[model samples]
Target chain A: MNLDLRLDTSGDFYARKFQPTKREDTLILNMGPQHPSTHGVLRIILEIDGEYILRAEPVLGYIHRMHEKMAEVMSYPQYLPNPARTDYLHGLAWNWAHVAAVERLMGLEVPERAEYIRVITCELNRITSHLLWWGAYLLDLGAFTPIMYAFDDRERIQDILQRITGSRLTYCYYRFGGVSNDIDDRFIEETRKQCSRMKPRFKMFKDLVTDNFILRKRVEEIGEIPADTCRKYGATGPVLRGSGVPYDVRRAEPYSVYDRFDFNIPSYDTCDAMGRYLVRMDEMQESIKIIEQALDTLPEGDYIMPKAPKKPKPPAGDVYFALEGARGKIGFHLVSDGDKSPYRLKLRAPGFSNLSLFSEVSEGVLIADAVSILGSLDLVIP
Target chain B: MSEENAKPEKAPDKEKEVKKKEEPQVPKYTGYDYDCFLAPQELLKAVTKLDHADFFLEDVSCVDMQEGFQVVYHFDRFSQPGRVVLRVMISRENPEIPSIYDIFPGAAWHERECFDFFGVRFTGHPNLIPLLLDPEHQGPPPLLKEETALKDLNQLYPDRVHTPVSPDSEEFVKEINNCSNQKSRNQS
Candidate 1:
């Protein structure tokens, strides 16, 4: 009965029945276009095994609204509003970068009062940007409560900035040679008061999420990008400083009234996602310091250069000007043919380069680790 | 530092006076050398030869010039402040340039974008494919040499009816081939 029931194969086919002679690689899976954790419409195609990722490729341009193309068709003055949409959080920083470039190209001088005001507004915007990032980054790491608390303080800055600039999210507040509006005594006093209030709240931020063990473990040592690799890829801003570069465009080039003010450029050499997080947090404090100094030395003059007319006439030549934006080095390379419209306009967006570094950094990282790595880079994905 | 100097305070209105006293008035800006303006043909080689010449190819799209296609590369130092521009002109028939991917890894994706928008090609690029356009798009590429694209479509397909190509098909095929070759090479 036993002999009749069983039969053994000569090649051990029965022993190897469940095993395949060859296994086809698994197909890559698309992770987002709808996922809230993606920050935006950023989609990542991951080739993974179980939970470990073998390859992670980010698919961008899902939101490429042809901003550059639109910039080409519009006049020089008309293109001012375009930068606001690129990074909605840091719209003013981009607006400042564009105007500063045009001012340099035309060889125009910004008034002392305008310069100080520009610095004050940009620094305040930078604080708001960092605060939003702090809340969003924490939210991405699965903490939900900080955003409302962060937004509560952020809205005050928004209200103050809006009172001066007239728009909340996409404010085009810079002119070719100066700012769109001047800050009155009441506005200056309100900003100064807000800074005093925000300092202790920032301390609360440090205590609340900075020391959370899960947050630290998720971001601290994962996805380490070395300083040299960072330099080669041309990473800038908080990402570059996070790797210990200490190269801030505000210090290096000194656009606007940045040279007149005194503030430390925060940098750390850890080169991890957590290192970036800490650098940005420290940077927010430094921004507040700069704002305080700018407010204390608020000058007396016209808000804009008197020579600049309603329509800008930048003489024929190329001028490349940059500013230290909240994200990184935001610059405008403007070529004017002595016309009302620019001959050629080149925008140097920091988010583009920062996003490119992700494919390299996330090569062997797990899929879960990749999202955390991207959040740490603090990009708006222009 | 200029911050310590009294020149800015002496006369903020005397901008022209300051420039005249600081340096000789040139035909253009004083910092750029007169000899640095390269012809369209020499742009690629000249830029590639500069010391520490990493290209922050921030954006690489083209405009439909009356003469032909003008491919512009917005060059800047990401960490440093210096910036430059390099423009290339290519005929509508075969628009191509030596890929700058070897110089800057970030440029490859930008080059694909140029291809997608303006139909220019980078000769030595590892991937010369469409970036933003849908392959199945029947209408012409949104930002191409409009007349040239019409001419191309007429020559390539005499009939008005044409089958659309899958946008990522070519890229997918090439990636698969490369992966297999890499696996075999690893085995060897």
Candidate 2:
């Protein structure tokens, strides 16, 4: 047998079909369905003229698990674990959106204490998410030390969360009307300690990472996305705030006890990767503020509603619920036909919209800056 | 094929439209500030109106019902937060609706997702390929209900009316303009 050792010159179906410009010198490149900078299995096909990108298109669906389809077949309680799997970084927010949507549809009244618990735990989870994004983003831009610092804080928060939430990363602690486990004094005390501990770390994070000339040089004035562009693509969370919109679902919509908490939605008018970077940095501090407020005023009552429906059958209608996740706004549109399972369940993953704008933003930028742009978006592709 | 099927029914629909001029009744606590049914032709116009009002498209979701395919478009504004849902019904035999990608560029991905799952074709979409489904997979759209599992409009929306409001009408324009101005649930 003759050994043939030559690379396959032809590309995959997506790359082959990717239309190239009429220019003769333009070369086609596939960034990843496995490249580390993408954070997940997201593939971006690029048309390049030397170091500059002519056009870019992202090919998704490598990790699509069809969670919406799963929601239709599973019972309400059985489907509780699915949302957390979608955006694992901010798992609690997705978990909250699922439970809150059902609660809104069935007119369930959550105990005030349970509402406060949700707020406290959810903010903690948000901190972990932003921390991970911060570390991973810095790593993407060629720095490795920050991730160690990120996971250090992340693990402590996870330890506190695990004491109550049971599991560490992909949490399913939230139930329909309230949380699964009540936070004892130990849990609250540990959380308060973590909150106070994180305050000084933010200052250190600024000195060690944010103000570093190399990191700022890599991100600042790169990938400038106008506020109008964000609206056009429906990007949300820190990406939208980074564009100077100040439109956070927590503030604009005020879900749970968020209205009672005093925290500012930080926005930067620079509209570059630096703005997006600063927004996430500022947001982690705000999360600590919200957690501190919720913990201070922690109410007294049931954690989960006493007689919450074990087998909820919402009336025949539809309800739309949206909450701000770390990456962006996570939405759930549930249509029920008076059934135990949803008639149709549609999940509005923020990363899908946030990532869609990449093809447009990545155009005409240097390939290295393109990586900077993608990292700043902080995508957890579902 | 869909255009022809939609046209013949227009004459009779207009007759029903006059009798049902009373406000479309949605449940008070359904989380929708402004909900209206629009004819397929009026969808583009209504979306354009929303774009002019500085509203951002949240998502486009489609539900399979016995009556037809109910395509839902959700929009909200940053300045004034209120959800405006536009429901348009299209025949299942030829499930086609005009794309809003031109008006709201973000909708390109959403419309593709709808097409991928429900097989609802969005006409005029630039790249209508599958966004989250395997392109080589062999099957009907995965989200389509089995014939036995489908629910009709009456069963699903028992108490509400299903009249299509023309986008050109004063009520439609006023609703689009004032949707964000309405007090949101959280504000109360």
Best model number under TM-score: 2
Q: Please provide, for model 1 over A231-322, each residue's C-alpha lDDT reduced to its tens digit, 9 standing for 90 to 100.
A: 55667888988888887878765566787877898888889988898889888889889899988888798998887767776654555556
Error of 1 at A72 (Å): 2.7
**Residue pairs in clash, model 2:** none
Candidate 2's DockQ is: 0.36
Worst 10 residues of 1 chain B by lDDT: B26-35
Chain A TM-score relative to the true structure, per candidate: 0.91, 0.98
DockQ of each: 0.08, 0.36
Worst 10-residue lDDT window for candidate 2 chain B reads B19-28
Q: List residue ranges in candidate 2 displaced over 4 A.
A: A1-8, B1-28, B181-188
Candidate 2: global Cα-lDDT? 0.89
**Cα lDDT for residue A200, model 1?**
93
Model 1 agreement with the true structure over B2-94: per-residue lDDT tens digits: 876876686675886546444521122311111122245555554454324443444554555544566656544444434444455567677
Best by DockQ: 2
* lDDT values for all models: 0.69, 0.89
